[model samples]
Target: MNTHAMVMALALLISSAHLHAQDTVVIDGAVTDRHGKAVPLCDVIFNPSGFIADDSLYFKCDANGRYRAEIPAGHYNSLYSLDLPQYAKTQLEFWGWNLQLTENQTIDIAFDTIEVYSLAVWASNGGSQSLFAAFRPMHLAAAKLPRLYYKNVDGTPKAIMDISPTLTKSDIQASIDGEPVVLIDFHWSYEHAGQCSAGKDSPFSENEPCYMPMIIAQFHKPKLAPGKHLLRVRIQDHLSKEIGEGVTHFSSNSMGLGF
Candidate 1:
């Protein structure tokens, strides 16, 4: 072979090697919370949009909130998964807990959530009764709040509400503790509100925006403001800040709030 041809062949080989090194590859990543820490025990599952369900295996985040999983081998062009709890859609609390892994790479995820502040709740008429009202968790607001439902005895808990823009909200159904319930749809709010009832036609039209006037009506919230007293526990989310003055009653004998 000619020397010139040999040189050209060597150049081609070098270029091919470089291209191979730069080729895209699958990936594995460790997911953690905002504190740059590890998640100890959260499950991570790959979405089936890329492949068969059995091929998709879930991983758990460790105590430090750190999780690791291999990218599945399949026809997937590229995909990823993070180890975290399923999303809470309300108020943006727990929506983005997971991460996606690209093919042939490692990722370090630092997830963050909105934090809330608060002060002690005091009612003018009551003697600082903190044993009744329950504070909602941040995840609850962050998650997709399923509207309770019961149609046939076997079709109960269908979670009938679908707030997506495409789904019409003209009619809604609810139930509590094996009984029928109703709520009023909101004009511009992400969530529906209304009074809960056990019988038929609501006081207002079924198409009205609201049915249960107060959020506490059918919730069995065990309110302490206007009544005598009842033992209840309130849990506050770190994300909902200062939970307002009279909104949530804290849990346990501890009122430190610790914020």
Candidate 2:
């Protein structure tokens, strides 16, 4: 191609790039706690709808819990806030789903609601962590004893249990469609130990048992007709006298599969 033609091609490429940049929208917001104070250094993630799990946009809020980013305008399957401080006490980490971003907008996050995170049912016997999904369906025949996993944003289970000796399995309550579901066992486990540690004078000893966030409850799977069902779980912290609850919908089919 001639020099002029090459120059024109370059110009066209630049123009296209400019137009693509214009297609982006700015997203800004602040993360606050129940006391209306900023939650600093919180992580925000936006997962594009119907995309791979690794495909996501991440941003971190400033010291005042304010965040801003320019991203391509599109729909998101989920928006999550992670790595929140214990003082936040948010019940849910997943803030929004099926979100559409067409223009610049401000989306503030707050932790005033509840105190649990990642509350969901697992289809396995709770022996291995591989079978865990935030919303995995429960197969009644395969997993007659499905387990519930959740985390307390306020403090670790061991710490709470230390303060409240009376805390027991009865503190956790579950129901399906407003019907009580019998719980068989309750236990606590760490979700991610590598990211947790104890400091000198910390309530934890030697930081040996840190990061025990996951509270598991095993229950008998009830028979259900094919369709959607609502599962509700309520937890009361005996030490703080605070209550946190979570609700999720699962589908049951003839094959005893939960969706």
Candidate 3:
């Protein structure tokens, strides 16, 4: 072969090897609940970021909630799973952000079933000095609630909000800056599914109507000295009588803040 052609061939081979190295990495892990119980039959979604392609990836777990996959090395926004029939979903917590996965690693995910996994408190309006807080009452689906079942257009049983659980103002006990505060408005926030696909054999449907639940409440900010303040929240399931609580510290300047 000519000298110029031989050099070109060697350069091509080196470029191919570099691309291959950047595209292959083994990730294996198990999804478990707060008590270390397997959260079976769910797909873990990895959302990519930055200059990488917008296509997301899914890792299907076995009935034992264990998964292993080969994915491209890149920066990712977060990894999370959708709600299962028997368990409430988890998101954005404990999952690393701006994650750079470049080598083989084990990443275990834990869902907060029957506990308060995370809490965030922030100032809603600076002028009004009103504060807002939200928390996940993990494993909320386990609570007893009356279900109104109906068939879908395809004759499949449609998922309905009738089975969705809720908490009243009486169910939450919150305190800010060591003083009692009333949770005036109580509501639920949901994260809908989009542009993600699950394995055909997986029990979780990407199009399922039900999703994870979050409890949000608002309280009037007390007149405190401008500094860091403590907010404590306790939540209870009216049906199961289970309780979950979390604490967070925020500053007086914590407008639109979250923890």
Candidate 4:
């Protein structure tokens, strides 16, 4: 063969050899604590968002802080993520590469520990609402947090039948269709930086000011039909002497509290 033809023949030989070597693919990863400690009870998914062992990109992490899922020899752009729902947190994960890999190839991954804090608030009415809250002496950051998530007696959250920032007995008793049995569930992101003071030449005017605190509640409930409703928020800031008192009214629709 001529020199050019010889080179073409050599290229074909290399391609043929590579095609026969790939067989099974391996998924490798480690489950570590915040301190790099290996975590047990971890499972990984091998789906399109996971691995290729099952054609889909999903699989579970095996014990020993390791994961290995086999896939056919080919290129795949699967997505991967952990399955932690109760808190609805999922994003950081260890699989689903955007590149191509051959069978029997091993892919390694590592993940960080996830953490969260929980606060429970009971519901009651004495023509108003009541609850206890506390904030200790610690440094606070500046960020908005999810304060509250309201739910129903069946653990289902209900929308505000009506909101009376300035709630009265008559307003509480009135109902749009009949009456709304709704309750407020409280939640918080716990990033406190609620302090801001404008120094000389501050852009803020006398009325516009900055405020930050430990607990700001958000109420996300099922949407209810239109009607008047009474909404109250009881807070307790143990560390802050000024706000550690009775349950305060955070908002209402009647008086257009949060309109």
Per-residue error for 185 in candidate 4, Å, reads 42
Per-residue lDDT tens digits of candidate 1, residues 1-259?
Answer: 8999999999999999877655544444455544445645655555434332555555666666555556443333112233335433312111111122324444333333321111122222233222111112222333244333432224432222322211122222222212432332323212234443333633333444421111121122222233221121122333332111111222222332211
* Model 3 TM-score relative to the real fold: 0.42
lDDT of 3 by residue, 153-240 (tens): 3455543333233466787887864588877777776433232233454344565564345667888766656555657666656775
Residue pairs in candidate 2 whose N, alpha carbon or C atoms collide under 3 angstroms? 91-114, 137-258
Number of the top candidate by TM-score?
A: 3
Error of 1 at 244 (Å): 23
Q: Please provide, for model 2 over 11-30, each residue's C-alpha lDDT reduced to its tens digit, 9 standing for 90 to 100.
A: 99999998887689898877
Give the C-alpha miss distance for residue 133 in model 2, angstroms: 10
Work out how many backbone clashes candidate 3 has: 0
Candidate 3, after superposition: displacement of residue 147 in Å? 8.9
List where candidate 2 sits over 4 angstroms from the true fold: 1-114, 124-166, 197-210
- In TM-score terms, candidate 2 sits at 0.41
Better of 2 and 3 by lDDT: 3
Please give the range of 10 consecutive residues that has the lowest summed lDDT in model 4. 241-250
Scored against the true structure, residue 73 in model 3 reaches a CA lDDT of 80
Error of 1 at 153 (Å): 30
Candidate 4 local lDDT, 173-211, one digit each (tens): 111122333323332222323333344634333433232
